[model samples]
Target: MPRKPRTSNISRSDYYDITFYLQHYACFHCRKAFKQSFDNQRTQRLCPQCRQPMTNMGTDFKAPAQKEVAQWRKVQSLAQAGIKFFPQWPDGRPGERPDTLAEIPAFLKQVHPPSEGEQMLERRSQEPQRPQTPREGKLSLQGFAPHQTFRLSGKMLITGDGVQVFHNEGWVNAEVSGHGNNPKQPSHLRTFKLVGNKLYYAETVPLDGTLRLRWPAT
Candidate 1:
């Protein structure tokens, strides 16, 4: 008889250890209740559809956790049978299942709070300040600091009465040289330039072509 081929054996403990490491790599942004070996680990950190980062979250995998997951699945199954998810939580005390995709941002934020740049923005927004009004019917450029970093991109149109009429941030106002109410419209109108900051200037662009000043008259 031909000699039987020797088979390499993998110990159950070894297999379990490998399983634990692959199944739970200290996830920081998402929980992995269950994963199958069929999933390729190399591309695990990105979504297959949108190519977005996938979060790995925290978990305490014990009997109580398993029970919670079981209860959640039971409720989710019931809801799939046309049960309303929120009206008193269609599946008794267990409640509804979260949409994994919808819950990603919350998970990531929890895992990784604001970085230094984002924290700086929060500080700037919270800085104490006062609102300013325009001067001399014409916007006095003196008080308003020029946006030096990025030059303003929009146009300025003055009202016939010498007022910089309507204003909006990052938009330009169209002019017909002097103020004559747009022929077809009840209110005089102007379209804004798509690029500049409108906040420093007194001009404005209404959605329907009419520009009105948002600043207090000087």
Candidate 2:
């Protein structure tokens, strides 16, 4: 056999570099946080206790104590508004998030402007309620097909194929799969994981009139 090259001759770059760092995934509803390791920050995780989707608070996030209900509420508001507690803002500015609840409104205004969907909702709220026609009763996914994507309440997106879901931004993948109606209750749609042919990591979304699910034009 031919002599092999010495291991010392190999450079560090020659090997595949997979560096994992611990990031915080928080469940605002549960008021708990968990640390998970991933090579990047875009990974979505679920709450172990509630099995509901959790928000990725990034590496620099320092979670408030569980007993701090008011602070947790503030954090929850920020997270739901698509704000991540990264070391820097999306615009590359150093993070200077509000420490007090009173300052949060102004800080959020400076950072995140009202999205189009939000503005529409606000305008609709200001408008007087009109009588509902037959077509405006309840939203339905009756004719939806596989691989087609639909937006949920302007915040989450789900494919009709039920294989993938994205929360807030499309690039951030929410790993839970399986989107369909609960067999026993057809009034609600559910996103879940199927493990060993049984339901796991499930979250139910009620098909109430308050939530709007629409297929966006491609």
Candidate 3:
């Protein structure tokens, strides 16, 4: 006699982490609900409290009561609007239909009462659809140039040396070769990062006021 084919072994990469926080299962014997994880292979799922084998309730085991009602109402509305259900798939399971227009009132009644789904669907279908407004455009600084001068209140002060100074016909780098108040004058470069809507500099301006290079002609 031919031996049965060996069960396929899964690779580590093929097995993904399964988190079943919201999903639940019921014990086969006691029918008590319990949360379960399918991460590791188990010969039997014995409940911690009952020690009974548990059966999977599947992914769609539970849903919000409101959402279920809303969905069924939508289906009933479509059916009432002259829609007909299409043929089901060849291998489809029960309660799972390819096209559900024909299953309206019955399918809906299973989830809700006699007329709740129908009433909600009728009320929703008659309400006027609101038009959505376009969102406001955000200001992008793609072409924004860095501020060459630091302006406070109304007084404008030169940033520092090494800044572009307007010259006779073109721009030239300002003299920045001195330590203190000597021949070339005190000069230092300041760096800043833009956070949200403001530019924040790393270091504060020195207490010793540095010389402000005269602004050249435009």
Q: Best-fitting candidate, measured by TM-score?
A: 2
TM-score of 3: 0.21
Model 1: lowest-lDDT 10 consecutive positions: 144-153
lDDT digits (tens) for residues 117-149 of candidate 1: 988998999998654644322222212212111
* lDDT scores of the candidates, listed in order: 0.35, 0.56, 0.41
Better of 2 and 3 by lDDT: 2
Query: How big is the positional error of residue 111 in model 3, measured in Å on the Cα after superposition?
Result: 20
- Give candidate 2's error at residue 136 in angstroms: 40
Clash tally, candidates in order: 19, 0, 0
Identify the runs in model 2 with alpha carbons over 4 angstroms from their true place. 1-19, 39-44, 89-94, 113-218
Tens digit of lDDT per residue, candidate 3, span 1-97? Answer: 9999998575221232144233345443453556556635745667767787654444333312333544444433533443323222464322442
Off by over 4 Å in 3: 1-23, 63-218
TM-score of 2: 0.40
Candidates 1 and 3: which is better by TM-score? 1
C-alpha RMSD between model 1 and the true structure: 18.2
The positional error of residue 8 in candidate 3, measured at the CA in angstroms, is 13
Q: In model 2, how large is the Cα lDDT of residue 144?
A: 38
Return the TM-score for each candidate structure.
0.22, 0.40, 0.21
